[model samples]
Each structure stands twice: as C-alpha cells, then as structure tokens.
Target: MTDDQAYAGTAEGQGPVQIDEELARHLDNKRTELFEEFEIRDTFPDDVLIEAKNATQDPEADIEEELESGDRVDCRDLTTCTIDPVDAQDFDDAISIERLDDGRYHLWVHIADVTHYVHPGSEMWEEAVKRGNTVYLPAYTIHMLPPVLAETVCSLVPNEDRLAHTVEMKIDPETLSYEEIDIYKSVIHSDERLTYKQAEKRLDDETAELHDELTLVHELADKLHEQRKEDGSLVLNPARDRAHTIIEECMLKANKAVTHELQWVRGLEAMFRVHPQPTPQEWDKALREIQELDGVSIPGDAWDDPRKAVNATLEQAPGRQLNKIQWAVMKVMPRAKYMSDPFGGHHALNFEIYGHFTSPIRRLSDLVNHWIIYQNEGPEDHDLAELCDHASARQKAGETCERLYKQFLQEVGLDPHAVNARGLEVVEDEEDAELTEEEADTESAELDL
Candidate 1:
C-alpha cells in the first residue's frame, strides 16, 4: 500500500482519508512503533570496527609523510575561510577570493584530501564503500569513515596545514565569465571558520575581518548565479538564507570545475553527479497539481522553460505557500544521482558536465573523483554503473533513516537520554545483513516514496 493510504486508513472502497489530528497522532504512534521495531543499522559491524581501527592507526605519521611528499601549493597567505553549521566537526571545504592584476576574480576552492590518507583498496576505503556516505542523524552521526580520519586528519580546521584537492578559477569580474580553471593538490590554512549565522553579518558590514574577501566572494557568487540563470538552471533555494548562497555557489563552482577539467582536460574515466532532465509529462503533472490544489496560476510554458516558470510561480505564490509548492514539485521530480558516464550532465544545475569532487570525507563518489583527479586512476576497473547504484542506494538509506529519526523526535519530544536508551538493541535478524546488493535494492525501493 502507498504510504499515504497506509498511514491514513481508507474506508471500504474509499481513498486515503484527509489528514486530521487523529490521523496525525496515529501516524506518530506508528512511527514510534516502527522506530522500536525496525531493523536499524545503528553502528558498524565488528569487522568494520577492526578495519577502521587499523586504517586509523598511525594517522599522525601518515599525515606528516603525505604533507612532505604530496604535490603542494602554499595558499596559506590567501584569505580563506570555512562557513558551515555552528556544531560542525569536520570542515571539508574552504574558499578564498582575490582580484587578479587583470581585474579578473581569482576564486580558490579547497576540498579536504581524504583520499590522500584512505588509499584505494585499503580497509578505510572498504568501510567507506560499504557505508557509501555519512548518515547524519538529528542527534548523532554514523560516519562513513572513522572519526580519527573524518573528524581530524582530513578535516580542514583553521590554522592547520591540511592536504587538499584545490580548484582555482579565474573569472572576469565584469562579465562573470570563467577565463581559466586549474585543478591540483595543495596545502591550505583556513583563516576563519564562520557559521551561517555569523556570515549573515558580514554581508554588508565592511569592518568585518576578511571583509574584502567576503564581499568579493559574495559578488562573484551573485554574478555566477546570474550566469546560471541565463543558462536556464533551475534555482531551488532549500536554504533561503543569503549567507548559505556564498557557500553553495563556491562549492558548485568547484564541483563544476572539477567535472569540466576531467571531461575536457584530463580525459580521464570518472563518475559524475548527474540530474536527468525532468520529463515533460512530470512537469505538466506538477503544474496541474499546484493549480488545482492552491488555485495558483503557473505559467503555461512552465514545462517548456522550467527555470522561468518556477520563478514566476514562486513570485506569484504567497510567502508561506512557497515552501509547500516547492516541496510538491520536488516530490514529483526525479532524484539526482551518481553516474560513471560524465556525458549525462546535470540538468538542474544547467551544467554540461558535473561531478562531486568536494566532501570526500562524507561521500564515496567524491573520494573516487579525488582518486581520478590526483592519482590518475579512473573508476574504470570498478563497475561504474554498480558503484553509482550502490552509492545512490546508500544515500537514500541515510535520508530515510534521518527522516524517520526526525519523525520520532516530533512524536517524542527532545529527551536525549530517553531516545538513546530506547532503541539501543540491534535487531538480531538484520544485524548480520550488512547492506548486501539485494538488501539495498529492497530497502531503497521501500523508501522511494
């Protein structure tokens, strides 16, 4: 049965009942019950634990050696910084901006070099591959890599000389045109770590430390945003805050730059983060639903030119209804995923080619991209299609786990002690099932809703 139908029980020969308080309570109860009953993989297996321990052993020595021998660019003098959540432990990406003598903007994006430590075919790599990505819970996180590696050695903390896969792009300050792209290994020292809350203050405050750099980054991002709009990119603001835009734009540029370099310059076999174009039928259905449900008038050519249509619809929508409409549209859309064939491109970003080269500490695809970018080892030996499929499945699982955990929190208010003690037991039946191919497929299909 569909989730809606299963949750809000249907009368004989009737459709799913409309949401009411009773339905809400009933759903909440069911979620709590499921939280207790569901076969949740809360922790790593003993084998994984042993493997992670081995991988993290002698981390200090490993890091020091890599720093000495690895390709390095001294970007310590650059006004680089990290913007993330206040409670974030691992700062995986950092950004810096400078005006070149030619009046073009030099934007530098440095991503944590997790692959430098987690070598191919190593125990940590195996663990990362199995977990796929970090499962971020509201209260805790199940990291893909052990904390020794993900939280410390590879984290781009301030003032630390960390190995990084760097993307340096020179863009015209006037035209916002990307003039040159350079991808290489580098060592960077972050000057500051600003949370989104702190970053919002720097928007117009000229006296802010690194104010000039922040302003340049913001302006470059704004220009790049306008350029993306011109390219017919579908702009979806999941986080509406302006401060978030600075980080988002920088990361997008880095990912896009890496993908473009791999596809055109290196000619290496690589995996990409691709978003297929929404089918005309899917677009039409979403618009029809919005019109019928909210009585909002969407542009007639929304399906033909989605970027314009969506913006116009949002403009017409009331501020409160904006999120509702966006959510509805997103529900009907296909999920973005990883792929071996870089030619698929990313329709949502309006990029001719795109890949996830940042956040290797969290994502396996990014780690693979780093390997291809730095080590010149393509994912050719691995079954690209299978790897992509596994990564996508793991990502979906993480999302599902997180969603369910949120529901649990809503049902039972924030009492950390109670929540922690409640479901500490592992399901004996499922504990041995370490996300095999068949199991992943079944779980992913179940959570596809």
Candidate 2:
C-alpha cells in the first residue's frame, strides 16, 4: 500500500477499515492476544467461567415466593425520586421530602430492600456475602446481584415500583439537625431519577421550576455538608486517584453522619473499616511542620481518641503537610474490617453509630445490614466472629480482583516499549531546581519502597 493507501481504501491501517481475514481472526479471538490487544472481554471456558462466578447465584425459591406474595403490600403512592450518577446501574438510594405543618421537614433516605430480594442463607445471599463488595472496574462492573436484582428488582427506577426500607429523619430547617428519626418498611415508585449534576443544575437555574422539596433537600444537605466541614472532617484532596467522582471519597463523604442510627451498636457486630491513628514518628514530623509553619504544636495523642484531632490540627495548621500528617496518623490506625462487636465508628464523623446502608446491591455490609435490620427486633448477638472472619476473607478477595484489574488497565494503557511499568515525568519548578536532568532521572528511577 502507498503512504495514503496504507490508512485508506479499506487496506492496511487506514481509515479505520484495517480489517482483513487474518486481522479479523485475531481480533475475534477471545482468549489470546486478540482480546488483550483489541480490548475485548475476558475469555474462559464455560465451566471455568461459572466457577469464577461461583459466588453469584439467585435467592432461594421460598424467599422469592414470599417477596412475590408481599408484592401486594405497596407503600404510599407519593412521588419518590432516585438520585445517582447518570451511568449508575445499582440504583440503591432514593429520597423523599415532606414539609411539616409547623415548619419542620422530614427527609427520607430510602435504600433498596435487598433483603427482600437476597434473603439470608439463600444462594444469592451466599454469593453476595462471599463477594463482600461489588467490583467497580472502569470498563465493567462485577455486580453482587444479577441485572434482575441490581438494575430491575432493587433499582428505584423512575416511575417503576420498587421495594425499599425508608429511614425518615425529622429535621429542623433552621438548625439543619435531625430532631427524631423513624425507619420503615415501604414500597415506592420513583417519580423521577435525577443525577447530581442535573439536580444541582436545576437548583442553580432560575428559569427551571425546581421542586420546593428538592430545593429544601439540597439546602439541608448543603447545610449538613457545611456543618461537617466546619467540624474538621477529614476532607480529602485526592493526589493519585481517579478524577471522576474521586468516588471513594465521594461515597464516604456523602454518607458521613447520614445514617448513624443504622450503624451496629451494643455488640451488634459489624465490619467497621477503621484506620488506626498515626505513629509517633509521623506525628513528630507533623508537629515539626506545624511548629515551623504556624508556630503551634498538635497533640499527637489526640489522634487515638474516638473523636479524631483532625479538627484541632485543621484549626491550628490546615496546610497540605498537616493534612498529610493527619492522613499518616489515619493510616496508622487499624483498617476497619468486618467485626461483630459494636465498636465506635469513624473518629471523623463523631457519631457513635454508623454503617454502610446506602449500596446494598453492591456491598456485603449493606446486605448484612439489611439482614440485621429485617430482624431488628430479634434477640441481640453483639459479636459475629465467624461472619466477620468470612467477610474479611471475601473483602480481601474483592480487593485482589480490583487491584489486578487496575494493573491490567495500566498494562494496556502504557506504551508498548514501557508496558511493564509506569512513572511520572516531573517538571520541577525553575526556582526550586536543584538537580540536573541526569540526577533527576536517576532519582526518579530509584524505587523508594
């Protein structure tokens, strides 16, 4: 082929029509180089693939039968709304707002009733428990539920009926505080599904007829957001993480102090993913940095308290280095894992109770919480040693899978010559330049760890 013809006329690599019999052969090959090169799906034999997903299965027949029968028990016909990302499939949280007669308001956080779908001891529940958490890969999602349960059954699809358990908190608009709260078993049909981007836009746009309730709901959430910030919450400024959502921080931040009541208490054991406080060495460095910058010293010991000294440090020295010190201290703390004891919650939230009740269809904790709440009136079993152990194992497995997938992305994303690793191309500031190109390259190439 000539230079232009190379990419043109359905010949070699031109005009996107690079296909030929040999090219097609490799491109369609699922298991080998073709799939890896063309970004096709993973290929394993049927039985092997089934074994890979050996964890996922449908709920027991009896449970589904009960749910089918309970279909008649629909909830208030009032309009409900599902708020999530535009591309979100696991629609687990819905919201409703009620204006009270005496100027108070009720904000309802309705989570998907996964227990009604994946009952305890059922195959689906077993799979979900074994998976521990949904794998949110960039290219695809490894879900805890089949599409039936995730996108259809439990999803709060707009205008479609869905089962849910609602947590309604009475709020004083002036104080932005929950006066009293009530949790209920209810069925709801969403009137609309709004993305955060869209919802915020509606609130910002003057010409749009924004719902009074949505305005109030955002107002309340903003107030809550502001209050928490003022309280010295460990606000993250992501360094090396995805730009979209900074999803990890976003979820944790969004749910902060939102559902403390549902968090396990009094030995109703759970997996509390806690982080231990920073070590003395790190704290000493933090103290030094604070003294150097702000002429102040933070009490490192305060980090061990259930109430984190994050706010104190923020008040005294809220610089990047101080934030790193707090993060280091936060890292030193034990990682929160599944446990049966009612341990204190995250120090940053300053709430004794809390749990991940938002995404049941995607998290084992949410599923377990759903199970626990279903039997909320049942006799207490404060600790769940065996359950917690199993949960931790499953969590480790999920993490392994997710990390491997990200590594795979890096492998694919890198230049063919540099496929084995990634590195930064640092452009040091001119004023701070202290190294020649050779020195910089040598230093950058050194593996610190």
Candidate 3:
C-alpha cells in the first residue's frame, strides 16, 4: 500500500484550483516554513537527479538483457491491470487474479521493482534513505526518489514490459489463507490502467472490460475484509468501497506474506511494521467515550476487544458521529512505527507480522525491504535499527508537515481539499480567482480514517 493508503487518506485531485497571486504567495511561504520546520528536502541533489535521469534512459535494453539472461521471470501475458486514483501519476503496483480448476484462488501482486534501479551504494538509494518517505502536502509532493526515475522506469505503465517484484500466492477459498507464496523478480505487461471510479464501474457493468477480473477480486477482497474484522482486526473505515477494499486487502496480504517469510521462513532481519496496543485503561477511556456518544453503542461481546468494539460502533454509528468515534479511538492509540524486530505486531491492522513490500517508490522501509528480499540477506554494515528509527521519525514529520500545510491552506481562505483535488493555479487578476467558502464547504467531507 502507498503512504496515502496506509494513512487512510486520499491524495487524488480533479483539476487545478485557480487562485490569485497573493494567495499563491501565502501558500508557498507556508510550505517553505513547514519544510524548514520538518527538515524536508524538497529538491533532489544534482548527482541524484543525473543518476535518475540516466537510469531511465535505457531501461528497455537493460530489461531485455535481463530477460534473456533468465534472471527475471517473464509473466507478460498475465492479463494484468493497474488500478489507482484518477490523478495518480506513477503506478507503483498492479494485480492479476485467476481461479485454479481445483477451486483455490491464485493472486499475483506486481510491485514496481524500484531496487532494480535504486540499489545499495547508488546515489538514488542514498537520497531515498535521507528522505525516508515522500512528503505529500496539499498541492505539492516532495518525492522520496527523483521523479525522473520513479515515474518512468519504475512505473508499471500499461503496455510496457516493466521490471517488477511479483508476489504470487495460492490462496485457499475456505479460510482465505495462503496455501503457497512465491516472491521473485519478473517482467510484466499491464494490459490496462483503471482508476478507482473505473474499477467500480467495471464491477457494476457486466460488459465493461476487466469486469470479470474486478468482480472476482472484489469478491475475495470482501471475504478478506470480513475475515479481518472477525479475527479482531481494527477497521476504521467500515464503509470503504469495493475498489479500495480490493487494493487494501491484497496489499496487506502481500506485505504480511513477505514479512512472514523474512522472519519465520528465511530467519532474516528486516524492517517490520510494529504497532503496540494501548493499555487497558486507555482502551477503557476510549470505549467509555464511544459509549457516551448519542447514537453510538459498541456491541457487548466486542467490548472484550477494543479494536472490534470500535469497528462495530463505527459500522452502526451515525455518519456525523463517525469522525468523533474514530478520533476517540485514535486519541488513545499509539503511533505505529517501523522496527527491526517484529515481536510487537501491528495493532491497527491486527497482523502478526506486517511490513511494507508494495510501495518502494515512496517509502524507505519498503525500499529497504525490497533490497533485502532481493539480496536474500540483511543489509551488512548498516544499522537497521537506526534506519527504522529514522524512517519512523521522518514519517511522523511528513504527517505533521501535511497537517500544518492543510491548516495553513484553511487559514489562507483556500480549501486544502480543493487545492489537493484541483491543483493550484495562479491567476493574473482577483476577478479570476476561483476558491470560495461555498466551494470549500461543498468539498468538505469527513476523512475516512
């Protein structure tokens, strides 16, 4: 999952929001202030940019040689497709699914093999380590890797045979458990790229392209979603649509599979996502707050598991009270961080062992994991714990930067959502200015998180 997905936030936007020169200046100044405060490096170094540019220039030739050398599996004919937000630029992941004759489901998750280009000792890799993760603001993005490389060679664009780290899983239909998991580098050709809206339409229309694939995956995803809740996993967004559910469940499964292999099977150290649970008192405090809400009541049985209680309450709570209930839970929830040890599992996702393997383009932890998985060894001479701490800290800084930037946008009479959906456009005159309070209010909706 991408950082935005992990955060349960959507960075998708429609068009550019036209603003006067004065407001644009204000936004720019606020961004500068936030970047300095967080120590976010917005610009790529000269050497890194040059390296990224050089890497993208000859990917096809290099990929052909690798394919010929038999180092990469060629799965180019797998009826694959990418689903992302409409405004998403570089597609980092794709999915392809099939049902075996034996009734088990076969799922293939293709994540762009960023390690193929940005490896250890490379300029891009060094820079990615420094950035930790991409800093996404309301109308701006500070990429972890240079866009020249990430958006080109690392992107799994349709019709292009791109290099990817594919996670192939044979899953049981009954328990939704993986019967077998295989991770390898491969060459894939994406047949199509569909936005979330398009994916939904495909599910609704029988005649739509990829209808069968989308429908099948959605069915599996729905089952996985319920199974997660049944297994005491915390689901903040009970009403997440089918498209988001498919991507989320699949990515979570893949991430869990990779980390499980690293820790249990390979017995190697890797970056694991660890989310500690709250204390009994903290849970009681949150539960009490939720119970006191006007129309929200946690199921009596679910009270034993705080995560389940929040899930049940959110599902039955009024739309207006949804945010309040979530905030109540979040207040007592500790921040999840990256760690070298997988002893403490992710509390929010309720996974025994979870780490990022999907979005290497934007996350340092995922990138490091990719390198480790490919090398079949831990990073030698590097302090994995220190990297984990740096990534966790940088992630917090990015979140803070985004929050403050949005607050600044609101203060400057611009809707951060509007600017996010529609990028900022500096107009020549005040009469041409676009944003209004009505527009902001109209765009306002409760954050799904």
Candidate 4:
C-alpha cells in the first residue's frame, strides 16, 4: 500500500489508526520485551520449589502447636478481621481492638509469621533475600516465596488457624499514647475478611456484621492519625477512604511498636525503613520552586514541621495540581530506605524508629524482622548493613518495574490525554491501510483531546 493509503484512516489524517486487537498484541509484545530486558524472574528455581514443597508437607509442621506453647498469647478469641484489596491472595495482616475496664483501647495487630517455615540458610530464605519483595504487576505478581507458602501455609486467610507475630498495644483513649506495648508470637483465627470497599460499607451501615468492632477500631485509628499529624508526620493525602485510613494507622503503630521493642528492650539490630529529613537548603530550594511555579507560598514552619508543611501547601494548591505539588516536594526530600542503624528515625513518619513488620509474605525485610522478633537472634552470618543495602536496591528495582509496566499500559489504553502526558511517541504501522471512517473519526477525536 502507498504511504497515503496507510495514513488515510488516522486522526484527521494526522495521527495513527486505532485497532483494539492490534494494540493488545503490541502491548503484549512490549510487556514480554520489558520483562526480559529488566530480567524480572517469573518463577522460583527448582531447588526453592522443592524445599518449599517439603516444608509444606512435613508431618511435624505444627505451627499452631508451637505458637500455643510459649509466651505466645492465644488471641484467637478476639473479634479479629482483615481488610485488604478485594483480589488479595495473601492476607498478611489482621487487626483487633478491645476496650479495657479503664476505657483504654487495647489494639492487637497480627502479621503472618512466614519465618516459621523459611529460616536462615534455607533455599526459601535465599530466594526471598534475592527477590526482596513481591513485584506486583497489573495482571500477575512475582512473589517472594513460592506459591505453596505464599498462598497457603503463610497466608493469614480467614477462619484458618495460623501462627503470627502479634503487636499488642494499650493506648489511653484520650491521648492515643501507648500505655503498654507487647510483641510476641501468637495464634489468631481471623473471624472475617473484608475488602476496603466492604469495610467502608460496614462503617456507613451500623447494621452490618462487625459494624461495632469496625467503628471502635476506626475511631481509635482516627485519634492515632491525629496524633501522627500533630507529631509532624508527612502525609501524602490521596483519595483514601475511611477503611484505608484505619488500616494505615493501625499498621503504622504496629510497625513503630515492633521497631521500638527490637531496638530498646532486646538491643537487637534489624533492618529499619528510614527516611532522612530534608536539610534547610533542600527545603528552601523546594519551597522556592513551588512558589515560582504555582505561586503558592509555604511557611517556614511547614519545613520545620512536616504536618504543617503538607497541610499548608495543600491548602494553597489547586485540587487538580495537588499530586504535581506533592511530587515536586518528594523530589526535594531524600528517599526512604532500609537502614541497619536503629537510632536513625523515619523522618517522614516522625518516629524515633520505624520498621516493616506487617507483611513478611511480601517483604524480606519484614521476614528478617520476624526472625529477630520470634527467634530473639539476628542473622549471625550476614552483614546487617549489606542486607539493608541489597534489600533497598531490590525494592527500588521492583517499584520501577511496576511503574514502567503501568505507564506502558496507559500509553496503549483508550486514554489519549494520558498517552500524550506520558510522552509516548506513536509509530506508524506500515502495512495496515484498511479502516472505517467511523474508526478514523473516533481516533481523531481521542487524539484531539
């Protein structure tokens, strides 16, 4: 076909022709290419799979018995539940709250005890350390553990008796300060599994099952959230529902509690998720740029106090440009990473120490923390600094991979404005010339947008 014929059915004869099937095939090919280019591993090695299978089938594998034997609390009676994404396969964390006779709130956060099966020097451990964390793609995931453990044994599914590392906190109802904090192994039976959507609905409907429990937990979480805000924690406000806020507050408290226990009580060193605060010069540069670009003036206290900074800037920024402003601010701040130094606080959260303790099924750093919490011993053979560096690097690589994949999908999807914003260059198909006028008009209209 002639060039004119090939370009005949484009946007006002200016852009490329549109075909759904062709775009799908092109995207699939691009996905394969990017995966190979990035060397993203899709499956576990034979040895890792074999070891995982044996660990699963071992007759003496009695996690529930082990959890029941020791200082591990039997918290199965608590009206516990998990709130996660609707399609989540691994329920790694669940929560429960109780009211003491003194009107204090007793909160229990249970995280999947993956270290129970995967130990040091094992194939599973080796693979997990190498992978660092699960890489979530749009349609699939590259899990840190094999499917047998990630989906079955270590998954904290509802109604299943499972071993978990629990963080129990007693908070004064008025202050939301921890009255007491305890961390130990525990056995928990999650009473129900609700997605974020379901939890939001339950919050709105008082007649829903576990509505009272959800309400109590949510109220406490709100208080905790307000406390964090007062503490100058940097919060990136997204379109988060109430259920998301509740889950986030509970998990943040649990992570902080675990970090506190490890560093203070046991004097054991573990990998911590740390974010360094911005220097005065860095903050000034960011503030200048934001003011120059958006004409928004952020106060000096906003730099000194992150909560004020976020609140003050968001108040001035237009609703449509909030994300853009946040991105600019993030660019000015140092990135968060895993650090072996327990004293290095998380600047973003405004915590003296913080950790990734809630999702061992997905994060290797959490698994390391779990081993330290449960075994009362750090990894003897490995260098803590080296592990932190490697884990942080792997986590960054996984995040980049996921972001690129999503950007590719957006470029090919039915959103011309997004594609343009993503700066995708359109390549003309050479041989395909036949297209209807309706298709051409549609393509033209989409591109013109």
Best-matching candidate per TM-score:
3
Candidate 2, residue 104: Cα displacement in angstroms equals 2.2
Query: How many residue-pair clashes does candidate 3 contain?
Result: 5
Candidate 1's C-alpha lDDT? 0.69
The total number of steric clashes, by the backbone 3 Å criterion, in model 4 comes to 0
Model 2's C-alpha root-mean-square deviation from the true structure amounts to 11.7
For residues 221-337, could you state the per-residue lDDT of candidate 4 as single tens digits?
888877777777766674456898888999988888888888888888898888788887777676667666565667666676544676578666666566666766777777789
Off by over 4 Å in 2: 1-76, 209-211, 237-275, 279-281, 284-333, 377-383, 414-449
Clashes of 1: 0
Candidate 3: misplaced stretches above 4 Å?
A: 1-15, 438-449
lDDT tens digits by residue: candidate 3, 1-449? 63213312333433467899888888888888888999999899899989888878888898998899998999998999988866566788999999999989899999999988888888988899999998878668898989876677788888889999999999999999999999999999999887787688789989877899999998898998899889988887778789988998888888888988899999988889898989999999999999999987888988888888888888898988887888888898888889999888888878887888899988999999999998987666579999999999999999999988887777777787667656677999999888744344322122211
Output candidate 4 Cα RMSD. 10.0
> Which is superior by TM-score, 1 or 2?
1
lDDT of 4: 0.75
Can you rank all candidates by TM-score, best first?
A: 3, 4, 1, 2
> What's model 2's overall lDDT?
0.51
Which candidate do you rate higher for TM-score, 2 or 3?
Answer: 3
For 117-137, candidate 1 gives per-residue lDDT tens digits of 676667677778878888766
Best of the two (1, 3) by lDDT: 3
lDDT assessment of candidate 3: 0.84
